[model samples]
Each structure stands twice: as structure tokens, then as C-alpha cells.
Target: MTSKTTTRGEPAGPSMTYSAIQQPAAMSDAGNVLMNWREWKTLFDCYIIAAGKEKASSREKCALFLHVIGKAGREIFEELDLDDKAKTDYDELVLRFTMHCDPARNVNFERHLFFEIYQGAENLILTQMIRGIKGSYMRERLLAISKLELDDAVSWCRAEEGP
Candidate 1:
């Protein structure tokens, strides 16, 4: 009888071995809790793809997710306000975990803070420019002006450098 050899030089037999994908680490970093959850979820997604379980049933996927998330994650999962159907849904479970890890953001508050920082940075840059002026007269004139803005400074400098 002729024997068939496998790609790894082993004989193709009924007792061939297969290795399962390694599970991702649990999300447990208290300091970086959100980041830890995001990273762990990404790794778990990769594991699902590697293990050829992408087409698995919702319940099966949910089970796999719970198993991989470890004790702390399971405790959090238990606290989530999900109905029976949602509890068995993989997507719903992921959404709940994501929401738990990341709190809701206030867009208006975030925008206000961003503008505050932006204005501060702009003022800093303008101050540095005035300080770096080669002409002492120009520097003193700019600094002496009360409530001087960037546009006013530029206009004043341009007027001084007239043709």
C-alpha cells in the first residue's frame, strides 16, 4: 500500500493532530481598564477568525466570549441589564461590554474643552513670536498694546514693514 505524506513530513493518517487557537488574556488592568477591554476584544476577534468560528451561532459566540473574558469580565456581564435573548446574542454582549468599559461622552463639553486648549496654545505661540522678534522696538510695541490679538499683532508688524 502507498503512503501519503503530510506537508510537515508526517504521514497522513487518521490520528493527525490539530491545534486550537490560544485564548486571549482577560481584561484586568484597573488603571487602563478601557484600553485593556478594547485590546482583549480585538485579540478575541482574531482568535475567532483563526479558529474558523466566524460563522458560529450567536449563542456559541456568546459562550466563547464569556469563557475568554474570565471571572472579572463574567461578573461585569452578570451586572449588565440584558434580557434573555440579548444575553445569548454575541453582538449584544459585545456592545454591553464596550459600553461598560467606555462611558458616554458629552460632545458639547468636549468641544468647549478643545477650544479652551486651542486658544491657550494660540496665545502661547503668539507670546513666543513676540519674544523672538529681532527688533526691540517691534517687540516692545507689540507687548505694550493692551488686549493685543494675533491678527492685531500681524497687522501692526505689516504696517511697520510698509514699502
Candidate 2:
């Protein structure tokens, strides 16, 4: 099936791994695709978090995630074999998903925060060109033209440069 909805314009059964999730008939929000933890997180926030008339409880959030996950996704979650506490906690569920599914977690986004200019005759701005960065990475240090004692930050940049 393309999503959880079948070609016949009906909800696919649980047997389908990539089944489209059950959304409110009135709500036009397309439900979670269950491809990866990040995608799930984004869509979950949109659809299950507050998409309904009222706020969904944490319990409902977990159920929503489980409902959308297909056979392979379900297998991964089961393999984690979380205890009741971990299973119940939504944040923990996300953590488990990231641990199991996100492949590039080791590549620190901070390194991409800014590109240090070695020398500048013109106006100097410590420029950052972090492509595909998820969250904010701006600071006074990033904007300042004056020399700053940012040993750690310089180290991160230099590491990328190499010998």
C-alpha cells in the first residue's frame, strides 16, 4: 500500500507493515509514515500531539506510534524490549527509536555551526554554513568580528580541516 490507506480507498489492515494510520475523518492531516525516528517525530508532533480537538495524552501518543508502525518497525521496537517504564514514556520511546534507527548520530552538528575565517582584510563575520542542521546554532560568538578565545570551537573546525 502507498500509505496506511489502500488503493481501494480503505484503511489497510495491521498486517501491512507500512499501513497508513487512522486519522480523524474530518482532519486532513496525513498520518505517520513510520520510515524512521526523525520523520516519525516530526509528523507525530503535527498529527498526534495537538492535531485533534484537544491535547492527546502521553498514553495516546505511544499508542499512535505503535498503531502506525508496520511489521519491521514493530519488530525493531519489540527487539528493544523496553520495560514498562521505558515503553510507557514517550521521550524514552523516541530515544530508543533514535538509538536503533538513526545512523548518523555520531556526526556532531556543532562542527557545522560556523566556518572560522583564518584571515580577513574586509569585514569579518564568523560564518556558519551548516547544511541539513536540525536546530538553532546561533550565538554572540558566531556573530562577533573580534578575536575570541573559543578553543573548543576552533578545535571542532580544525578537526574537519585535517593535515
Candidate 3:
């Protein structure tokens, strides 16, 4: 649903803003709330949506997401709470990413790396992110984001957000 606001003494079409998940309206005014990477990822999705539209500046919002991700850093990764095995796999994935972010390589190569990460990782969360991609280009881009070498023909299934 769209969020409307009072503007010029009349209702505006919709507000070009969204609250952070940790700052949900249902929550009380209390201490700082901790958020997991999955939650942050959802916020990331919303930010992408808000930024992607023609009405808004997608690049600016995406840049903000990059900033937020960088600031969160280890905290974001910690919140992922992956098992020991998964953590090791994730670390290797990140290592590959660092190696491939070479100035000599094309940006498309980095994208391909990410795509592999998205597809290769066994983490349900990461897998779901890959499943979200629809079009071929988007699917390829998802794979390109983190080029993990997982087997092809892995079933694409919708990710469930448990309550």
C-alpha cells in the first residue's frame, strides 16, 4: 500500500519515504534495535524499489544502500548467524569477490561474481535472493553479483520468511 501525506493542506499522492525495519511503527520508543542481515536485506530491497522508480533517483538511493552496507560491516555479517560450514563458504565467497574487484577487470565481471555467489551458496537467504530475479538479464546479473561456481539446474524456489 502507498503511504499518503498531507502536503499543501491536501493529501499528497504518496510519500517517497519508508521507515527502517528496526524503527517499525509497531515498536515502542526504546533502545536501539538490532537487525539481522536478512532484515537489512529486506530494507535493501525496499530501498532499491524506492530508488528504482523514475519518480525518484535510483542511483542516489542505491548509493545510500552501499553506504549503509559498508557502515554495518562485520555487524551485518555477524547477524547472518550462519553455521560454521556456511560461514566458511561465505568467507570464501567474499574472498573471491575481493580478488575479482580488480580495476583491470570489467565491472561486468564483478557482477558475474555476485551472480555466482547468489546461486552457489547454500544459505537459504542468499538462494532466495537469487530466486527473486525474473528476466534473463536480471538472473544473469544476480549470478554475476558474486560468481560462485555452483551446479546449474538447481531448482528455483520461492524463499519463505518465517514468522
What RMSD, rounded to one decimal, does every model reach? Answer: 8.8, 15.4, 21.5
Q: Comparing 2 and 3 by TM-score, which wins?
A: 2
* Candidate 1 clash pair list: none
- For each candidate, give its TM-score against the true structure: 0.61, 0.40, 0.24
Cα lDDT, model 1, residue 21:
59
Question: Per-residue lDDT for 126 in model 2?
Answer: 28
For residues 1-163, could you state the per-residue lDDT of candidate 3 as single tens digits? 9655666444566654443333112211134333343454456556556554323444443334435555444444455454655444533433332333222657888877886776544554456656765657656745765544323323332222223
Ranked candidates (TM-score, high to low)? 1, 2, 3
Ten-residue region with minimum lDDT total, candidate 2: 123-132
lDDT of 1 by residue, 68-114 (tens): 88988998998898999998999989998899989898998997687
After aligning candidate 3 to the native by TM-score, how far in Å is the CA of 1 from where it should be? 26
lDDT value, residue 76 of candidate 3: 40
Question: In model 2, where do residues sit more than 4 Å from their true spots?
Answer: 1-35, 103-163
TM-score, predicted candidate 3 vs. hidden true structure? 0.24
